[model samples]
Target: MEKAKEMVVGIKELSSLPAVYHQVRGVLDNADSSIIDLANVVSVDAAITARLLHVVNSVYFGLMSRVDTVSRAVSILGMQQVHDIVLATSVSAMFKGMSPANMNMTRFWSNSVMRALIARTGAEMVRAGELERFFVAGLLSDLGHLVMYEVEPKLAEQAQMLSVQSGRPLHELERELLGCDYAEVGAALVDKWHLPPRLGAAIAGQIEPALADELYRRDAAMLNLARIMTDAMEQKMESEAIAELFDESIWTLSGLKPANVATIRLIAEMNHGEVVTLFFPQLRPAG
Candidate 1:
């Protein structure tokens, strides 16, 4: 764990979120801060403001009327939802132009968006509150791998290759080879960033939700299931094959049955392209 924390500390400058995000966070942390105050801070950053409006008006939100201004959007979505959107967009912007070795940025983000959508859909199925948090959690779940590829490209590549060839879990190989897995590294980064403790807990416990604190175990389990569904989609597995991948514990922890996999996956696939483009417009659709 110290090693993971150290790795995050070492790359603090490289992984830092934009200043505007911090400014928004500051407003949110203030008890007296109003929606207008939050909106004012967000409006200062033209790029964030534009992206926020775009997402607000996107089909995903399903708003009856278009939102032309940040303040109106803030009123409609409430403070927490707006903050989550800012965090998500800010994170996507942070990774722009970063081309990590041995990592395909396009494919990585694609899978991430799919995972996020699946998690969000699953959350809705379970009537889990804070649906946006689930989306952000899923989107950021694999962030440890990004850090690994940046800080330890060779070892990360080796672990990835060995996982593929040996048919072992990537995190297991990462633990053996790199002394820490992507989940730990990612959780460390989340803690370092001072993002919500729940987000970090979910990331850390994703590999083994049962080991997570009971408060966050359900979230961790949801992420684990999301990753499995994303992998199934990538492999083009049949619904039955995907169902075969889940154990009873996974179903219980996630509050989802194998029967739910197909619907969750379809929701993810349908939204994947649009959400990916919303976050990463620079990425051309793959052939």
Candidate 2:
């Protein structure tokens, strides 16, 4: 439709996935793919491989081995963990030079990395399987909001203003005022990019917790809790609507506890200062 066209045309900041990254995605989607397949794909892209290695050895993974090769890194972190890192590193690169109006891409990506890390930690703590994909889903959950900023700055700004003034979630206000929310637009991007189905579903269903498919319901909850953790850590107001939207049983099923919420929030806040290195190696702190 017209909206789709506008989105495609206006998203000049969005970059196409590199060939190696595309191959990595393919291998990730296939059940029979192995670490050697990922290592082969990663080896072809020296820049990505370097960045991937840098990220893996960084404080994020806490690897004591000082990994220097893709194969060894894969052995240490597993194929899926590398996939999540590639996806995050790739997307982060695309947004480096992109300065959205009324929004800072650096800060935006910082917030995203924080959400992803928290989601992964929360998933592991709560026994959610495939923690890495949940991390990627958490990272991309807000992608629609980015698209809105690119495609319709005026409307995006207005929606943000309204959300702030009315204390309503931005996605809800965006749907009311603009006929669509970022979650849907983000889902469209995921489809366009041909990412894993779980990622698309997770982004699309983030705002509307009830609409997520059974397979991605856990992803939705992970993203939901990740967002809350992010906001609570930043001392921003928590999304009461989102908190109430997902049932307590989901959290219990995931093995999360109310008592640990404060601990996670504090750790996430402390980790925020290190987030820049999740992408920019040159910005990494000195030992």
Candidate 3:
């Protein structure tokens, strides 16, 4: 735990969330703050304003009317949802230049976006509220790996290689090799960044949802399934194979069945390309 803290602290400046995120968080934290206050903070950053409007207007929200202004978006989505969107957009922008040599930025971002979509889709299937939060959680779930690769590239690479060669879970190998896993590091990073505790808890306990606190156990379960689905997609496993990969406990925790995996994957895939391009435009191919 200390090691994880140290790593995050060491690279705090390099990995810090943008100032606008903090300002928006401040407004959200204040009960006295008005919708206009939050909107003003978000709108001040043109990039975030544009992206936030795009996401809110996108199929993700499925609102009947368009949300052209941040104030309108705030009014419709509420403070928490607006905060989630800002955090997601801010995070996407934060890591633009921090890709480590050992990682494929494009593939990494693709998988992250896929995991996010899968989690969001799974939440929708289960009738969960605050579906956008699920997407943010899924998108930021693998953040520990990015930080690990940056702070301890050699050890991180070794863990990955060993996981592949031994066919063991990467997080398990990471624990043995680095005395901490991506989940822990990721949780620590969010904590360091002053993100909501729910986000941190979901990322930390994603590997074993049963171990997470009761309040967040279901969220952890959702992320666990999302990771499985993302990995299965990456490996090109068939739908039956993907179903076979889900644990019964996870299905119970997430209120999802193996039968739902195909639909979730389809939804995630349909949105994957567009989201990847939205978050990481540099990856879009030349026309």
Q: Which candidate comes out best when scored by lDDT?
A: 1
lDDT of 2 by residue, 158-215 (tens): 9989988989988778877778887788887887777888798887777545567877
Q: Give the TM-score of candidate 1.
A: 0.96
Global lDDT of model 3: 0.88
Question: Between prediction 1 and prediction 2, which has the larger TM-score?
Answer: 1
lDDT of 2: 0.74
Worst 10 residues of 1 by lDDT: 6-15
Model 2, TM vs. native: 0.87
Candidate 2: segments with Cα more than 4 A from true spot: 1-9, 29-33, 236-254, 280-287
Candidate lDDT scores, in order, read 0.90, 0.74, 0.88
Count residue pairs with overlapping backbones in model 1.
Answer: 0
lDDT of 3 by residue, 186-254 (tens): 899999888989999999999999999999999999999989889888889987889898778898889
Query: Residue 229 deviation, candidate 3, in Å?
Result: 0.9
Global Cα lDDT for candidate 1:
0.90
The predicted structure with the larger lDDT, 1 or 2, is: 1
Ranked by lDDT from best down, the candidates are 1, 3, 2
